[model samples]
Target: MAHEELNRQVRQDLRVTDRTSHRRLREQGSTSREDLDAVLRAGFVCHLGVIVDNAPMVVPTVYGVDFVSRTLYLHGSVASRSLVRAPESTVCVTVTHIDGLVLARSVFEHGVNYRSAMVYGVPRLLTHRTDRRGLLTGLRVLTEHCAPGQWEYARRPSAKELAATTVLALPLDEASVKLRSGPPDDGDGPDAQLGLWAGVLPLRTVWDDPEPDPALTAGVRVPPHVSGRGHRTAP
Candidate 1:
């Protein structure tokens, strides 16, 4: 299907369902596929939560979201037991961006301004023993997602290095986005007259000057894509 058609279909399909998850905070939750896309695309890294052994684990890793295929691609060492087992069962992938600190009048009212999404699905492993081309493509996309200009700038991975890597794809069919923003909720409460200050302290991430490796060549200039982003907002 065309990208536009897929988006429309996904959105329509999402709306017809009850759209409730296990989250207790229903008011902050959203079933919009667009919101899931936005949250995933806006961030490159995610937390992969799965049950390894008898215990739960949340592994932080870089990821790429392909809207065309509606899959979330994850990469890690092939030797990792967690990576090996991720494709065998259902897992939850999450991406979150902290926008600010919500400082309320009462300690109990303190909270955070954040945009987050959680995806639940079983993953498909792509390796040299499986689909090699898909593995490379997923790795390239993952690199580009995390470091935009570095994929093309660096040399391609060798066969030996490729053997050491593993790629996993999880469909985005089951996902939800939850976001909380703006100021404190206690401004209109009885505590409003406490005379204490209470409001949101906004936070943001920005790209700073790039530092060259000390062992690098002396005359090489920083690339435009790497250098020009100083002070620019980050996803």
Candidate 2:
């Protein structure tokens, strides 16, 4: 999507407006649906923020996004007060991945290198069965990010289980992305003599060996995707 179309006219006042510093990086923080979808698809976990009783509450949960529909799907238990209280208000969804740690010669220059995306919009309740089914598929995409084949192997949710869960669809408008990478900047004259180890310590997320359920019958093989897993793509 075009930048103009994605951010034609956003509200002047929003929580993200304050968090959005650095105009150049903010522009790099794309509002395009494709960018948002890529960030969402690259990972399963996200931090969801909503107001409850006029106080800010942030909860970590799984999320999925549909670029075509420009919708973000979130799932939580029916008993979750955060979801119940957030229907009428705008919410912020954030996805972040720490790529590396930047260690400088001086302690003051130390920082974390990361890639992150933030999305803001009002969440709408899903009612129509067709839309609900689509949202459920998106949810499955999140739940099985590392192991795509598990969606079929795992027992599907029953009717009662579905009813007890709350699924929310939020628009993909009013979003931003930010990223920082590479080594630290130490001054040329003063720090040249301090031969300290100043470089990036890379971090990565990988799949560990699968642990099957203890009660499972013997001879059930692990799924191909899980067995042949490797490092996930960074957002």
User: How does each model score on lDDT?
Assistant: 0.81, 0.68
Worst 10 residues of 2 by lDDT: 9-18
Residue 93 miss distance in model 2 (angstroms): 0.7
Question: On residues 197-233, what C-alpha lDDT tens digit does candidate 1 reach at each position?
Answer: 9999999989888999999888988888788788889
Candidate 1 backbone collisions, by pair: none
Q: Give candidate 1's error at residue 153 in angstroms.
A: 1.4
Residue 214 C-alpha lDDT in model 1: 94
Top candidate, metric TM-score? 1
Kindly list the per-residue Cα lDDT of model 2 for residues 92-167, writing each as its tens digit. 8899988899888898888888777888777875533536675566557545663577878888877666655666
Where's the lowest-lDDT run of ten residues in candidate 1? Answer: 13-22
Candidate 1: list runs displaced more than 4 Å. 1-23, 78-80, 83-87
